[model samples]
Target: MKGLTIQQMAIGDSATFTKTVSESDVYQFAGITGDFNPAHINEEYAKDTVFKTRIAHGMLSAGFISTVLGTRLPGPGTIYLRQELKFLAPVRIGDTITAKAEITGLVLEKNRVTLRTTCTNQEGVLVVDGEALMSPPKA
Candidate 1:
């Protein structure tokens, strides 16, 4: 579970994590975060929205990006600093998503890594895209 420190990581280093979005997953995330947005938690309310159906929370998918940083690319002991994300398409229940993170830049002095982040659904549709800045573990 040792994470790659700044020096141990290369510009092309990358990792991915995947999961199927489910009704229970959505409800659990909603309860855990207290988001309770009807578009996420209520079908009747969601039907009136532009999405026309309940959708998983954008942050739910974003959290999957963290899975890559914390457990795969950087492994354990990584310190998350910042992230900028864009939600491109709706993530519906039963969609399988793969969250990917690739090292794009490194700052030796700062022990920081900049990664291009993305999530694609089972249909290969881009659901979320972003950039993350993180402090890799110290050696």
Candidate 2:
């Protein structure tokens, strides 16, 4: 797809993408973020938690939305201005998460776009819900 500029997008435009969660992904994210919470890395410790298994970090799921906006829909050169996120459910290893975004508002003069964001698991359960404001390239 061609790169999107601020003037080229409109309210109600949308995009979707999916990814499968893996143990390695969780570990790597833990390493990078220094968030080595046992519930996210140790199965035995997770077994005692409410989830009963290791779960991906909430930010990891949110990253999927960022991935779509920065690399696929609006594409390279897009600038993220703001984001509001709510973590609704745990994302377990082996679950396939689908991240979706729909433009809710656009301020052409300011070059800002607001999007309704959601990430759901294969079971159709929402894992994350949020809004993101971005500035796509103008030229």
Candidate 3:
């Protein structure tokens, strides 16, 4: 287990996870989450939308942030408390997305940490940005 105790984290501690979005990835996310939004699953319908083509579900990319939080930084036993996100750009099939979480604040008394979370695509365009509150594993 990669759990990091609250004492082991600092204001700048960070971690990242990346993956290339694929058609299969999108469909799998749709099936699991029951999102099935046309913007994500229907190419022809997407063509008429502002994206002009199919785009991956925003939450699918957001989930990458969870990967970083749960498996990398304050890893394993970290408890996710809250998150606020802003979707800035569309993620297309084959776009490699890198999700990062950097510690920004800590509440020692509550054993909580605040992280600046973000996801960027292959073109360096920010696709998602957010803040997350979590509880690091006990020492």
Cα deviation of 81, candidate 2, in Å: 0.8
C-alpha root-mean-square deviation, candidate 1 = 0.9
> Tens digit of lDDT per residue, candidate 3, span 1-139?
7599888989998999999999999999999999999999999999999989999999999999999999998899999999999999999999999999999998999999999999999999999999999998998
**Which one wins by TM-score: 1 or 2?**
1
Q: What's the lDDT for all of these models?
A: 0.95, 0.90, 0.95
Model 3 per-residue lDDT at 94:
92
lDDT of 1 by residue, 93-136 (tens): 99999999999999999888999999999999999999999998
Q: How many steric overlaps are in each model, in order? A: 0, 0, 0
Say which candidate scores most in TM-score. 3
Better candidate by TM-score, 1 or 3: 3
Order by TM-score, highest first: 3, 1, 2
What is the model-wide C-alpha lDDT for candidate 3?
Answer: 0.95
By TM-score, is 2 or 3 better? 3
Ranking by lDDT: 3, 1, 2
Q: What CA root-mean-square deviation does each model show from the true structure? A: 0.9, 1.3, 0.7
